[model samples]
Target chain A: MRIICCVKHVPDTNAQIQLAANKKDIAREAISYVMSPYDEFAVEEALRIREKNPGTTVAVITLGPERVDQVLRTGLAMGADEAIHILDPDSSITDPLIVARCLAQVIKSGGYDIVFCGRQAVDNDAFQVGSAIATMLNVAGMTLAGKVEVDANAKKVKVERIVEGGTRQIISGSFPVLITAQKGLNEPRFASLPGIMKAKSKPVTKKNAAELGVDLNTKMIIELLEVPVYQRKKRVIQAGEDGKSAVKQLIELLRTEAKVLE
Target chain B: MNILIVAEVSQGKVKRASLEVLTRAREISAGGEIAVALAGAYSADAEKTLARFGAGKVFYTDHDQVSRQNPEAVFELAKMCAAECKAGLILLGASFLGKEVAARLSAQLGAPLANDCIEIKTAGNGVVVQRPMYAGKVIATVQLGGAQNIVSIRPNSCVAKESPAEAQAKKISLDSVSLKTSVESLEIAPLKRPELTEADIVVSGGRGMKGPENYNVIEALADKLGAAVGASRAAVDAGWRPHSDQVGQTGKVVSPKLYIACGISGAVQHFAGMGSSKCIVAINKDAEAPVFKKCDYGIVGDLFQIVPLLTQELSNSRD
Candidate 1:
């Protein structure tokens, strides 16, 4: 059995985000980058499935600048058999569909039975790419899968989705199923010294859109990004001798300014 | 202008988030038709509750396929209802189900969808929605490009307002013959006492809580105040708590009336999850803890000593 996990290199969520002086985009001068937090679940799950079912291969694919190779290496260190980097070093694309198109090309020819992605990238927080890819591929897809069980013998898959207010479980008929893993799907293992050494020797394949018959120059345009205005910054109304007095003042602000309370 | 709400019901029960959406819809678009597109196997009790919350017309789709939580099926049904009612705006709760369904529905209907919105208002030419970006550090006003505006409001962001309107709804059922997916299995989490996001008061612990067994302080205080137990990413990563209880950028985003931090030196990601809370009370031995900056009240003392006293005082006051 073969599983393909889709991952992305994003700005390290732990870093402080500063709006560019132009207010159009995020300033990227000194920001560090890493694999998205949710994708960690997907990558870890793929590794475990390969380990549990000996003779299975796991492949990690990502679309981003050349720096994305670092995330691929991280996955290789964790246990992936191969890594595919669809390098668009010019920083030209931002649309989820474009990302999905690149993935669809890889999935169509890669001969993988299953595909996985983190529910959503914390950077964009759009939650659209996986489902969009499923739509493009015309295959069964499940988002926010809390648990998954593969029936290798019967060629079927059962997945439980974490929905609002409750959960929904669904089973798919065959391979080519796309799923997004939720947190707690598996405990992502730390890279060992031997594994890191072996990762350096693993094959890291670079495929551009033109090489894959996709237009790398095609870009999705985004309007200027703006941050919300905050007149008050880090000013907490410390509790005085009477806590009730502080609460009263807070109520007044909520009523008049925030207008959230009645 | 008309406000349309997708009345989300599962297994014949109306979700609290749907009621919360109705309240928000009313606040944004004052006194509109408030039409509700009700799908799934809704019971009679659920229909009446939908009407009680100012739903002028309840377009019911009682198809078995609609009963399943498939985004394509639900979006098809919602699109038909929106067209039938000629609604100017459609509001859905930005829960896990709502986000995907709303996105596909908007795509199919050629309408713009503003996702996980905290606020929505009728702006000139369209509706302007406010959503938190960059993990709650900044809010952005997202504009949808279409004739009819569609938005998914984030759950737990708005409280349900009760202004009972007496309007008997017209139920309409659709053909359920062509369905895409089927529910195969279900494994429910053991019903814990409190849902993390719904709790009015939340008492969260961190690595400073010491060990998994020492989480008793959080549980005790949470129990006394009828609150839910939460944990920081550090605690969850350390295997001291379940990932389900983790609150941070990767974890659940929550806003409660009161949030108490025990032994937690707040990280930016952790604060992003619960920073918008009504009142924050921090307890840490380190006076220089970052949590003190975001907290409304701070106690510079050991959580081991202060938690017990606070739990006892709260329990006594409740009695």
Candidate 2:
């Protein structure tokens, strides 16, 4: 069995995000990058599948600049057999379709049985790449998957995905499918010292977007970026000079001002 | 230019989010024809409801295979509708279904897409949109470059209004596209409470709630206010609540009218999910909790006392 996990190096969720002088993209400097949180779940799930299927090989792929090699090494430490990094300086400006196309090229050439990716990149917040790749490849795809059950012998997989209104949809699809990881899917394993040391010598292949036949042109242009403005008048209630009376004032306010109550 | 709005129907009624997308489409039509596509099992009542919302033409498809929340089926139908109507702009609500359909359609048609857009407008024979990134910390204004544009409007940002225009209804049945994926079953939790995303008011608890059994206090508050129940990641991780009740970066993003946080310390991840709420009220025992700074109202008190008191007050005032 062969599995491919697509990962991304994004600014840590806790990192402070700043915009470039042009306001078209984020200022990359001074920000720490890590494997996107959901991607950790994807890599962990891939490793678990490899463990279950003795002969399975899991390869992790990333599309980014040279700095992203660090994340690939992290994936290697997490037990992926190899890493493929598609080096594209213009990666930040490209749209999700371009990224999906680049990944489709590699996945098709590798002839992998299944593919995994995080539900969305925390940076762009565009939950499109995995499904776009599936559409481009004409394969089955499931996003926001919370649970996965693979039947390698039957060439099918069952997935329970999170839907709107807190509903779960159990979906089944054939092999050569794509699944996007969601939270609570699985607990990711931590890399041990020995594993980290071993990952230093693992093979990390690099390719350019042009080499993969992916067009560098994008279908959208970012015109401007700005910090979100809050219009609410954050009026903190003065608790009527005491805690007990404050509750009374709050209820009266809710009834008269907010009108949420009564 | 022709514009097509993909309407989502649930339980034989058009979803408010989808209607909001139609409203947005009407506002940006700029003398162009506005059409709406309704897939899945829809009633004539739904079509009439959509028509009243200014749908010039209603394209619909109803079949067992297409009615099971199948993205491929809906994508095919949307693509066909776009092509048939010669639409230059395709709009849908950025709900689960809308995101799936727009993503697939954008890839198959090679169109530019902007997902979860808070604002979209006609820009000189093209379209420009604004969407939040970095978990609602920043907003990006983007210009779609392709001849065809697909956009998913964020829920609760756009309001649906009645225009009461007559619509010409059209039913389309296309050749079946091979579907490699099928929904086997849907296990929906039977909660009489309002859905978190759709609710006007949300009452959320956090680690301070202490235990799973203590959630009853939060539930009581929510029940009194007719609000949905939510929990922070800390509470969910502690197994005090189900994953579905979680509201954070990894959980559901909600923009309710009123958000009352109980015992939550106000982590950035939790704020990212509910930052867009219209009104925020934070109640915590810690006076210096981060939530106090961001909320519209703050009460530094024990949730155990405050919650029940608030619930009792609300219930008493209802009479």
Candidate 3:
């Protein structure tokens, strides 16, 4: 069985986010990049599946500039067989649909039985890519999957997905499905020294839009990327001149500022 | 053009979120009639209650197969109803079920959907939706374009509106289609009286709470104030609390009115979830804890000493 996990390099979630000087996007220069939190679960789950059924291959695919090699290496370290990078060095793209179309083209040509991605990229916060990819390929898709079990022989899989205040277990016809994993689905393993060495030797192929029969040209582009306006920081409203005064001030802030009155 | 509000019924009662949707929908659409599509086996009381929310017409599809949770069937019925009514905008709650239904419906209809929107307003370009990203750390204003724009409102984002529009609550029978998946057997969790997501006040513990046994102080304070219980990533990882109760970048994002953090050093990941709370109270022995920077109020004392006294005070005041 062949599985492909689509991963994206995003700013570390732990980074101190500051608005860019131009206020178009978050300050990315000083921040470190890592695989998306949700995709970590996807990659980890893929590794678990391969472990359960030997002879299964898990390939990690990412689209970004050469700097994203670190992200691909991170996946390789996590036990993926190989990595593929779709280099877009300029980082000009902003639309998720175009990205999904390109990925669908590659997935179709690669003959992957299953494809996985994080539910949404933390940076763009667009959840459309995976669903759009599924639509483009005309296959079953599930998002925010908590638990997944594959029956390779039956071409069916059972998924427990989050729904309104609860979870619903649904089964879908498999062997051409897209799924997005949420965090807490699995713990990603650290790469060992030997595995890290092997990752460097593994195949790290590159595919451009032209090679994938996808037009990289875009009509609508982001005129600007700006950091959203941050609300003013909370002032330390000194409560009455006692230990209990602070508690009263806190309650007032909740009622007046936050408006979460209990 | 009519704004079709999708009514969700659970065990024959209208979910409160639907009313909130109608209220928000009422504010956005320009004098458009609010119609509802009730697509499950529902009681008559539900129909009347839905009509109270300014729904001039309620189109219901009741069938045995769709009485429970069935996304495919719900989508089929919704598609038929939406086409028949010529809905310009489709609204659903951004809950677990709503996300699936909205995703399927948007894909089926080939419409651009904005999911988990905290607010919706008409923009010069189109409808602008403000949705919280990175667990409310960032809010994005989105411009959606399609013949029909589908918007899913986040749970607890909007207040329930009470607009007295005396409209007829008519029930229409609809057909049910076969679903690809069926529930074999289901196990339901007992409902906890207080859920962290909907709690007005939340008192959370972290690694500094010391141990699992020390969590009693946090729980006692929450009980006194009728607040929900929350935990930091450290406490959750140490198995001091269920993961569901963890609040941080990796856990549930909540916007309670008041967030009281005890012994939490306020890692950025932990703050991402609860940073949006209106007022924050940090109780830790360390005066330089990171949580202090984000908190509106701080008590540089042992939480063990502070929490019990606060709980007793609240209990006494309530009595």
Clashes of each: 0, 0, 9
| Model 2: pairs clashing at backbone N, Cα or C within 3 Å | none
Report the lDDT tens digits of candidate 3 across residue range B90-151. Answer: 88876555655676676666676777777788764347677766666666666775678778
In model 1, the Cα lDDT at residue A179 comes to 80
Shift of residue A32 alpha carbon in model 2, Å: 1.7
Q: Best DockQ goes to which candidate? A: 2
How many Å off is the CA of A125 in candidate 2?
0.6
User: Each candidate's DockQ score against the native complex?
Assistant: 0.25, 0.64, 0.31
Task: Give the clashing pairs for model 1.
Answer: none
User: Candidate 3, which segments miss by more than 4 Å at Cα?
Assistant: A20-22, A87-89, A161-174, A210-262, B39-41, B63-67, B70-73, B166-180, B183-186
- Tens-digit lDDT track of model 2 for B92-145: 899878988999999988899999999998898789999988778778999997
Q: Candidate 2 vs candidate 3: which has greater TM-score?
A: 2
lDDT for each residue of candidate 1 in A137-161, tens digit (9 for 90 to 100)? 6566777777778877776677766
- Give residue B64's error in model 2 in angstroms: 2.1
- What does the lDDT come to for candidate 1? 0.73
Model 3: residue B313 alpha-carbon error in angstroms: 1.2
Better of 1 and 3 by TM-score: 3
